[model samples]
Target: MDVEADVIVIGSGPAGLTAALHAHESGARNVLLLEREEELGGILKQCIHNGFGLEQFKKDYTGPEYAERLIEELEKTNVQCFLNTMVVSLSPDRTITAVSPEKGVFHIKSRSVVLAMGCRERPRSSINIPGTRPAGVYTAGVAQRFVNIDGYLPGKEVVILGSGDIGLIMARRLTLEGARVKGVYEIMDYPGGLKRNIVQCLNDFDIPLYLSHTVTEIQGKERVEGVVVSKVDQKMNSISGSEQSIPCDTLLLSVGLIPENELSKEAGVELTPITKGPVTTETMETRVPGIFSCGNVSTVFDLVDYVAETGMIAAGNAARFAAGDWKKGRNPVEIIPGENVRMLFPQRYSFKDDLILFVRSAKPIEKPVNIELSPLGMRLKRLYARPNEMIRFKVSRDKLKAVTGPIEVSITER
Candidate 1:
């Protein structure tokens, strides 16, 4: 079989659906959303916790609730949806090869493509946590899905290996569900999750959080029995004689999320090493002219609101591409990371459109910080941000057009 659309979305997550919605509103009549999952909500279906949609919806909602709102909106649009379909590959010329049980194998020729495949958690094997392969080990997100969506408890006693948002949320959730949360360990001196999450999920639950620590080893054969944790020095080296062990039946890893870009790479899209997402411009257009990216697939976002906002930009640009109104020939400058700032997404910037630069600090900044553009040395924006928070600002096309050198964004304590 063969399919064709003006715009083809590779995922039906919030980013993809929002993009499809925006594309339809932007006058792209034939937009198709492809979802590999049996359902449309992506990982949100597993995340039942509240604290979502505070920005976009102006009200707090659970993950599923927020997704439901968007899904409902999608039903009123011209966007067509294909569930249980997997995009096998993509070509530079905007050709997509996908497969589904009912539709068999098919080729899709789209005028533009949006990549919103989102991200996946880093498994225990990726971190090389020396341990016997055990059955009780699960990523925090997976554990969340099991407990929240499937009504299944992962274990009775759990020790989380990272202080990420998922791990923190699970600590409270597992405890609420009648599990003993041993503790959450972080290799960094500070928590990896948002400070609010640390307070609400861990502190509020009285769950211990060990900072500057890591799981040195795991002791288990069939199921997780316990884990050996150790404090790390300033250099991240284990402090001598600071090892401790905690007995537990499960170990949940919430170390980090990595952007899903295998399909983007297969389609020959350039990627930024800092964010591990496809290199994009202000329009969210990737190196491949007709390919755009957003959401966790473009960069991990602290809030879903930003994902939806960015998705609209990608969708609008993709719609223009589909309408034959996309203009090429703009030279985009690379965004370079500087002091105190770990990395910035949309690694590349274009003067053709206003750029919203999203960045994270390398460490907590308690005082006000100035985000300045280097080389030319102009202050772009000022923010009072903690390391756990994300800072975003827009650079006007006029300002971007004035840059004669690479764009550098740095944070300096006020």
Candidate 2:
């Protein structure tokens, strides 16, 4: 069969749901959402943690509760949601090929599409961890799903690698569930999780955090038995004779996250080297005219509120683009990261509206620094910054009229 939509949002997570809602509210007649999972809310389904929705809802909520609230608001309208539907391919012409058990196979032609497939965890293979084949190793997110949703314990004794937000949260989770957490190890000198998470999940539970340390060898032929932790020098190489064996049955890794953009590649969208997601305009439109991207598909964010915000921006622009009223500004400026910055999203912009540039610092800056637009005199000062959390700079279009050539953002100490 054939289907059509004015706006087609993929992945019914917070981003996708909010995008579809915004598209409909912005005057799109036909909005549809397709989710590969059995239900809506994406990863939030298994994330039973309580540190969500504070920015959007002005109150804290568990993951499922936040999902339910968005779904409830979505259901109040007429946006159609197809669960267990996988979008197999997308074309530059905006034709989506999706498959489902009930529908057999179908094609959707859309005026505009919002890609919000979110991101996946970087696994052990990505980091090249030396280890025997074992059954007890899992990503921190996968272990969270097992414990929170499936009601199964992954292991009794755990040693977590990469003190990311998920890993940090799981440290507390496992400890509260009667599991013995040996310690949390990070290759970076600073904790990889947010400041609040580092305090609440690790320090509150009396869990030791070993920075500049990494697991060099995994010791097990079957289930995970232990890991050889080694301290790394300033250059990130393992120092000789610093190996310490930590006994544990399970290894939960939270090395990093990768944006899922295989379909974006299929659609021939330009991707940024830093964000590893699609290169987009300030409106969140990919180089391809009618397609849009947001949320983790663009860049992994620290909070769900920012994810929803990007979704809203993408959807509104999608509606405008579908209606043949999408505006383009005069000067097209390329945004780049300077010395202390790691990744910057919306790498290209035209100042269509008030723009929010999302960026991550390369390292921790304890002193006050200026977030500057080089040669244009736009600067925002901040007291502290870290790699785990992204820095957002919202600048008005009028403020950018003076900027010529490319706009580069640098964090410099005052």
Candidate 3:
């Protein structure tokens, strides 16, 4: 099969769904959306918890409900959507090779492409936690799918490693499902999830959270029988003589998330080491012209609202590119991460329009700190900052009207 479109979105997640809708709204005549999964909701289908859509829609909603709202809006558009379609390859020239049961092999040539494939959970093998080949080890997402979607429980007793949002939520979920949650252990001194999740999911449930701790080993053969937990120092090395054996039937890992950038790499798109996502400009355009990336595929966002926001930005730019109206920055200004800033997005600014800068702190900082934008002498006061919670600020073009140099973002005590 061979087809063509004005814009082709490569996933059916919240990002891709929004991208397709925005592409149509942006005047893309032929917008095509493809999803590898049988469903259109992506990971949100299995995420049964609430606390979503608060910022985007100004109302709280469950993950599925949030996705349903997006899907409903998408249905109102003329964008064509295909499910159970796996895009195998993407060319830099905006050619996509995909396969499906109905269309065994197909090629889609688009004027522009929007990559919103989102992200995936980091598995146990990635971290190399010493353990036997056990049947009870599962990533937090997989376990969530099993329980929430497939109507099956992983085990009766569970010990989760990593204090990520998913792990924290799963602790409460498993507890409510009659599973005995041992505790959640984190190698970092600070929790890896939002403060609200730590409070609502773990704290409210009376689940213990152990900081600066890790699972040194998994003690099981056929199935998980127990786990060996240990404390770690600042360097993250296991502290000797601090091992404690905890009996459990299952182990869940919520280590981290990595952008699904296999297609981006295949297309020769530049990727940043920190975000593990494509390097994009302020318009969410990749280095390769006519190709845009957004959502968790750019970075693991804390909120789905931000993911949709990026999709709109990328789709609008993609539509502009397709119409030959895309504007390029003149000598784009570089944005550098300064003191206590772990990561920053839109590494380069066009300096022609207002830009939203996303920043992540290197470590936890106390309240009354200032987020300083250098070279402009601009500062925004924040109560506190954490590596888990991202910082977003807008840099107006008025401030860059006379500036012709790079800008640095840093965090300092006020």
Please list the residue runs of candidate 1 whose C-alpha ends up more than 4 Å from where it truly belongs after superposition: 380-383
Please provide, for model 1 over 235-301, each residue's C-alpha lDDT reduced to its tens digit, 9 standing for 90 to 100.
9888879989889999999999999999999999998888999989889999998999999999899
In candidate 2, what residue range of length 10 has the lowest lDDT sum? Answer: 324-333
Q: Is candidate 1 or candidate 2 better by TM-score?
A: 2
Taking every candidate in turn, the Cα RMSD to the unseen true structure, in Å, is: 1.3, 1.0, 1.1
lDDT of each: 0.89, 0.91, 0.91
lDDT of 2 by residue, 1-414 (tens): 299989999998889989999999999889999999898999999888898999999989999999999999999999999999999999999999999998978999999999999999999999999979798999999999999988899999999999999999999999999998989999999999988988999899999999999999999888999999999999999999999998899999999999999999999998887998999878999999889999999999999999999999999999998888876656678988887989888888776877798888898998888888887777899997778889987988888877778888888888
Whichever of 1 and 2 has more lDDT, that candidate is 2
As for candidate 1, its clashing pairs are: none
Rank by lDDT (best first): 2, 3, 1
- What TM-score, over all chains together, does every model reach? 0.97, 0.98, 0.98
Question: In terms of TM-score, which candidate is stronger, 1 or 3?
Answer: 3
lDDT of 3 by residue, 99-216 (tens): 9999999999999999999999999899998979789999999999999999999999899999999999899899999998989999999999988989988888889999999999
* Span of ten consecutive residues with least summed lDDT in model 3: 345-354
